[model samples]
Target chain A: MQVLARHNVAVSGVEGAPVIVFAHGFGCDQNMWRLVVPAFEADFQVVVFDYVGAGGSDLAAYDRDKYASLAGYASDVIEIVEHLDRAPVTFVGHSVSTMIGVLASIERPELFDRLVLLGPSARYIDDGDYVGGFSSADIDELLESMDSNYLGWSHAIAPAIMGNEEQPALAAELDESFCRTDPDIARRFAAATFLADNRADLPRVSVPTLVLQCRNDAIAPLSAGQYVRDHVPGATFGQLDASGHCPHLSAPAETAAAIGEFVRA
Target chain B: MTQRLEGLPADVLCGYLEVGDDGVVTSANDEFLRIVDRPHDEVVGAVSLSSLLAVGDRIYLETHFRPTLQLHGEVREIAMELVRPDGTKVPVLVSADMALGKGGQFMRTVVFEARDRRRYEQELLRARRAAEEAEGRARRLAQTLQQTFVPALVPDIPGLEVVGAYRPAGDGSEVGGDFYDVFQLHSGEWVVAVGDVCGKGVEAAVVTTFVRQSLRALAVQWDDPSQIIRALNTAMLQHGTDRFCTLVVLRLLKEDDDWLVTISSGGHPLPLLTTADGEISEVGASGSLVGVLAQPGLADARYVVGVGDSIVIFTDGVTEARGEAGSFGLEGVLGVLEAGVTSAGDLTDNLLQQVLDFQAGEARDDIAIVSIRVQDDADEAPAPAPRADVEAKDRALRALQELQELERLDEAE
Candidate 1:
């Protein structure tokens, strides 16, 4: 039988319970949130879907140009939340997806209750009067590297691109699935997600926000996390014991607990 | 005439069967002659096995086909060009299975055509090559554009000497966002600034240019360095994206007959100062980085420079440069300075050279370093006496004048 594209968006708890939408960052699909999903499954309607070209979603839905920016990913989150017809959903995003969720919540404030940003950065480059941790030069070098190793674009770069180094090995059979993406689609998504800057939308987010910063992420450094807190008005900034870019992959239990308490409150 | 095999299924067994010891066609089914396209009488006994193959297939059959088939009595899959009597060539996968007699000697040969699979494989190879070429072009263009933004040399100034160097990052195709500019402010004071923007590409570069230009304007008109950072912050807030940038700006003033360097930082690394006595120290200004926070306070540092002292200002590319084990950091910068201890003029060249050597001569990020050395003031020197030869000439002229006076007196007499 031909494999059918299916997205299992489930709500296991009571119907009237609060909704929590888990948006995964680049490189992986909604599967990264699996470790944290079970914690809230009993109390909240946990919504998850493959972002266009990832996981079990229809591969035909991914457009190279549209997904070349975080805005496109943010649009997907908005659509999924609205489709579920949930009120005041809580969005928990990792890495650049945090900015994605922020932009989405800013557009439709009534759709979200609070934001749990895991390793968020408004900008990655250092400016004359700002310290974004990495500079334009650093990012340029990274992009150039990806272009040079086009043949190893998926199998080689994708593994090193996201998640944490503490858990070096792939979780199980996940590595194959991670590299199984269409390379061209992954390239476009990488360009869009990493290169995007959403500092402007930080002030526009009227919803309550909880920024869970990884203490030591090579990708999202501490300075960038502080920038997110400083810019987003009334946003709570809390440093986690996590060490890598994907806290959900490394320390999901603690990450989920933090999100759960914020959502319940 | 060759007899047609009656029981052979046409659709399932589209391939033809060639029967004989020398591989001459004894008989074939309807599908067999249709695939190879040969007249029954011509190919039945007279045709050599190699007659159906093109030149390439003839070479393959001679070099790789006959030996394996005769010795092993099995011909594995071999892609060959099949030649029709009409002189047209079609690519086909040829697999010959040798059917053995009671004594285990070869008897009949069955050849199956894999025309469909060959066409699919060729198409896949062509598409892969096209994609590779496109990626190569994009990488080349990105590298070329990145080179265009980096300045070849720092500006030349009298009294105070300045030197600058920029190293691009490891990834050749991505444009670096690290930039540094040393220009004489409109007020006649020299303003030197080095900063790293938040990300890479054309957008970050636009911000780099805006920040560089804004710094120059503010350094000329404004007095306080922190106020200039504030102005830049306001300007960036007006049109800048969510991304912010960090930088270190220094304004050099000729105060008390010696150079006084006023340094300001917006979450940038402190400037390293090397005195004439070879004492090295870091000037600290760790305030909040610009654009990240509203009304951010920029840290300002003031230090006096004696004659021959130097100040080195650099972006994180110089400090966080990845050597064999991650980043080299500030110690790497100081180590280079300590090993090759020299004045600012030589320090800039030596420091850049050391960084190049440490990175194995290939820079991974845009590294911008500006070294300013205070020199001995020419105005403090005493005027030199006239040369002895000129003095002798003056004495000779006086004697000639006295002789002329005597001659004139004789004339008057």
Candidate 2:
């Protein structure tokens, strides 16, 4: 399959302009950036796509061995950018995707001009002296929490949410499905996201970087974000007034404005 | 109506709470206040609903639950926990909806106590994990048992090259019935056999083990290919196995500069013979099914294969493999052979890869292939001396001829 089709890539905004790709985090699809996408549509060409197992992308494309590490996700990003034939493009990653962008930029630094890391944590589990906010038990509890919410991820619900002809009203009501994923895929993704430690890779980044840290974020603690900033050379840290792991969802206007300032500069 | 509306909080069985877009609790019913073990005044307009949840559920709310509510306008049966003032957690099922209220927009949530359900689910989860572990153990055991049926390494014959490949069907979680082995018999001949049992899993594995062991034992005592297979069939019947098998056996013996190959089949696919110029044809005769009929039809076909000739034998898994176009039949095998695969390893590897590609990398049946090729004379540069066994056999034949001549001369005198 074409990399663009494999990733379910959607490109919009001004053509022939500098590109900005938006990559969502663990729980949601590209719709996580729906509120912030319009802010850059008039000036820069915008790109948004779903990871293989998360959204409308081909579920058959999810190979367990390939996606076992962050590097596999990084390859997807590199492929998408290469397909666009637009080098030195800006990448905006949230949550686990932050490391994905970091790995991608490190591998092919020429393909990326800048990176915007939103609520990113280099590692979720605390290692020795470094504080990553949650313990290993907390991650297990988080998995259990996910298990309890399997009702939202049923395959039976996906077709209806994707726009079933028999249930037009229900389909129309949820035209923009967000945070819907296969339960098994979600469990693996959660493990990959939480168990990964990319602290050693931060210094290898060569692109201009921006770290957007949200206050009181449960998933990515402030220290984790600061660690990313401190380790990545010439990285700028911007604190958002929003409180949550997903500032782009909770406080979109502020989130977009912060990103806009960094990208334009 | 006003009085009923005011009394609904106290009358309802489940807990209810309303929070604004900012997630702070704006209103709480008496049932909710009781569930949290907090006074009504302390909860309403004082604390955020997220703060009332456990840490894991709090993360779930921000990452999954809240985004789901915002995009779909409602979320159903989300499992979460509510923390009490005493730091105890109340397991609950929450359903919330986004609605436009008198004060801009708010979320109305209903909480149902689910301690029993949570415990039940936990048990189910544990059972599922245990079953998965058991299946993993079974799969590994099956693989180990399967390795015993095939030779770890094919004995290196001086003039002949041999290669074998096997792929289990599906995700390889269950044992497949197909097996192949290349081994040297005590009679100074190489025997190659490929067979498929009637089914899969541990049951088929049992039959495969029996067949492989029987063939090895029979090959050691018997020189004729047909006789060895017939003996194996008799052994299976005597053993009273309900399963049946299809097998093809080839015995190779050095004949001067060429190798004489004897092929026999018991309801197995015919082995293909490829010439140096890529001409492909079937070599073995069609035989009856094994372990069923009292008198099974079996025959041995012989062919002399010289340098740059190959004999490819495989289970039905190869020709019967279904794809988008159709089953990869004998024509597909011939097509691959016609493409010019000169070596035994190349023939086996290419045929397996072609079959897998035909089926889109998902093998519905186990595939086993064995190929034997007589190496080209040019490839064996400095020719070595003949083997001692062959030399001894030649000397014994010459001695018998000279003794017969001497006995005839003495009788004439």
* TM-score for each of the candidates: 0.44, 0.80
The local lDDT score (0 to 100) that residue B82 gets in candidate 2 is 92
Q: Please write out the lDDT profile of model 1 over residues A1-265, one tens digit for every residue.
A: 0112333344565567888888766656666776788998888877776677765666767777677788777777777787777767888887777888998998788999889998888877777776676667556644553443343334422332243243344334343354235657766766675567777889888999998887646556788888889989998878877545666755678888788778888
Tell me, by DockQ, which candidate is best: 2
The C-alpha lDDT values of all candidates are 0.67, 0.83
Task: Sort candidate 2 into its docking category.
Answer: acceptable
Error of 2 at B72 (Å): 2.5
Worst 10 residues of 1 chain B by lDDT: B379-388
RMSD of each: 29.8, 11.6
lDDT of 1 at B171: 62
How displaced is residue A33 in candidate 1, in Å?
60
For B293-407, candidate 2 gives per-residue lDDT tens digits of 7799999999999888898999999999999999999989999998897789999999999999999999999999989889855564343243533443354344345435545
Residue B33 lDDT in candidate 2: 86
- What DockQ would you assign to candidate 1? 0.01
Q: Where in model 1 is the C-alpha error above 4 Å?
A: A1-265, B1-33, B40-89, B94-112, B159-163, B186-188, B200-206, B209-224, B253-260, B284-286, B302-307, B321-327, B343-366, B374-413
